[model samples]
Target: MKKLFVLFCLTSILISCKKEKTTENNDDTGTSRAHSEWNDFGLKGNVKSTLEYTTEEKKDGGNTSSVRKFENQFSPDIALKFDNKGKLINKISYKENGNVAEDIVYDGKDKMISKRNFTTATEYVETKYTWEGDKNTIIARRFNGSRLLDKEVFQYNNGRLVEHYKYDGNEKQANRTSFSYDDNNRVSEESYFRNKPTMQTRLSIEYDDNGNKTSEIYYDKNFKVISKTNSVYNSYNQMLTSQTFTDNGSLDVELSRTYDDKKRLITKESFEVYDNSKNKEEFEYDQNDNTTVWKVYKNGKLVSETVYKYDFKNNLIYQIVTDGKGNEIYNKQIEYTYDDNNNWIGKKTTVNNIVFYTSRKIEYY
Candidate 1:
């Protein structure tokens, strides 16, 4: 099915705060840290460096019935270096053979300044970013050796991104996007133009008095509505229902969710009008609000269930999945080794009796 909400997706990216930390906490390894301090890397406590690698047992076939062989040695996957404040400074990713695949560098402000991707032993692509005096990025240029490949230029209004333009290697305009904000400082409209000033598509958003997004409308170049989505929120500002309609005003998809008193999602239900299919998911959480059980139902019939087990430190240690008939389909168990700061350094995961190990060498400031 053709997704009619493409414009909404672009608006979201253009409106979000650039410095906001988008990374989720690492609960599986019990590595807990302040979001602001860790930024988007999710590092734990004053970490200076980290090297991660994994090892897997060899098997005759890629199936559970295959004969297991000796386990391979750990192959380096990634290496990261952080500054005294726990901000990532450098990162290197490796290929399966332990060859450097990509190297990325970040500035003091934790903004990525350059990335070099190794395509082969002698060939690479380099991309560089230029910021506008500690504000939004002004330009990004990609190069193949010394030859310019493409570039993007950004314009801002009072620190908010207002326009973005893309150009080909020859400096010819490829496309452009412009944004407008509402009285609340939220992006209320976005327009896209392809190689010309004529808008090809547009998206408009509406918000409630409490700043909750209430609806989004997609429009074509003629400003005719292509699709519309309406949302309902509870007193806590939690979205309770979202429904999308087609150009003809026919319901396309409807999603409803219920949350606990703590604002954690407890149940979600979705229906697709085209296929007449209904699906539901129920969630159970532990005292710490960690998800412990998840059950899926199709057309009101139970289909699958999953259970999660966590350690005393709130690190996920085990998980099992079963079919509706209660037959075990998948099982996994993890054993962790932690450091004095309670950060896990090593972990062994066994899935369906097949073992895989991952190790992390972390240096703290």
Candidate 2:
């Protein structure tokens, strides 16, 4: 469900300029410059734009090498195009059967301005944005065929998002979120609401000197304690233990983690108030920091295990899971193709013999 929601915003794929810096400049042309942003996405840089198309096919169990299409699926056959700055510009969505569904356009600032739905054969929605100075903060008004649906007013402080207020069609405050940041520029507290000035939930967090989260507290609308979690870390700043307590001060859940000499997580054990079952998981990583194997245990006995394999480019290529007795439970294989810049341009995955493919067309400035 969370992944589906993120699809609408492409939130996870957005690059943070503050955390990235150019790493290399190829010759004097400036066209083949390499940067940390490329490494972040498993590419070799020089990428200017990208257009991704994704689709899937299910195998016909009755016949081998045969497949059929359906109307409803996990993701529509949508093409997402991003500019040189990695900002999404145009999104063309197609129905499961390959017919145009919608076409969305974004402005130079990467703000959605219009969306037309082919099925409806009309403009579904249009948005107008009013910026606040030079910051990314803006007030966005959404319209459904000239009828105002809602407006979102965003506030930022020192380049950090501080608050957002949403108003419904009637121009009444519908919901809002407020954030407070610590000295380290990390969010220290967050509050949510369904109505203006009325908080539904609030979360307060504390961190150690090493920037590791030390504690978190959840509060109800009335600021009553809902739950509290405390974390203990080793000298290496790795979490050694975590305990969560209920509002009544009862230990609700506890987790103990063990790490290898290289500071890699090796095992994790969990305990809960109701079940107290000995649930544990062990992990082994490859040289590339990828988890190569994972073992699950119950009552000190191994229940299942999973093995992962990656290609030379550090792409996960295969995964296999088996029961305690070594009976195969699940398996998947993936293949990929890369461009001259070492950027992945195509991907194919087979799960239980059902294939899915995703292809990308990239352009450079």
Best by lDDT: 1
Highest TM-score model number: 1
Clash pairs (backbone) in predicted model 1: none
How does each model score on TM-score?
A: 0.80, 0.67
Candidate 1 lDDT over 32-58, as tens digits, reads 444434544444566788887766655
Estimate every model's Cα lDDT from 0 to 1: 0.74, 0.69
Which pairs of residues collide in model 2?
Answer: none
The TM-score obtained by model 1 is: 0.80
Q: Residues 1-365, candidate 2, lDDT per residue (tens digit)? A: 34433331131112110122234655223544342233334444444556556666644676535232321344455555555644456778766555667777764424565665554544465556565555545444444457777888888877888998888888898889999999899989999987956789999999998988899999999899999999999999989999999999999999999999889999999988878777999989877666788888887888777777777766767777777889876666778898876667887866656676777787754
Candidate 2 regions with alpha-carbon error over 4 angstroms: 1-39, 48-95, 99-152, 156-164, 176-204, 219-224, 234-238, 298-303, 337-339, 343-348, 355-365
Model 1 — which ten-residue stretch has the worst lDDT? 66-75
lDDT value for model 1: 0.74
Q: Where does the lowest 10-residue lDDT sum fall in candidate 2?
A: 11-20
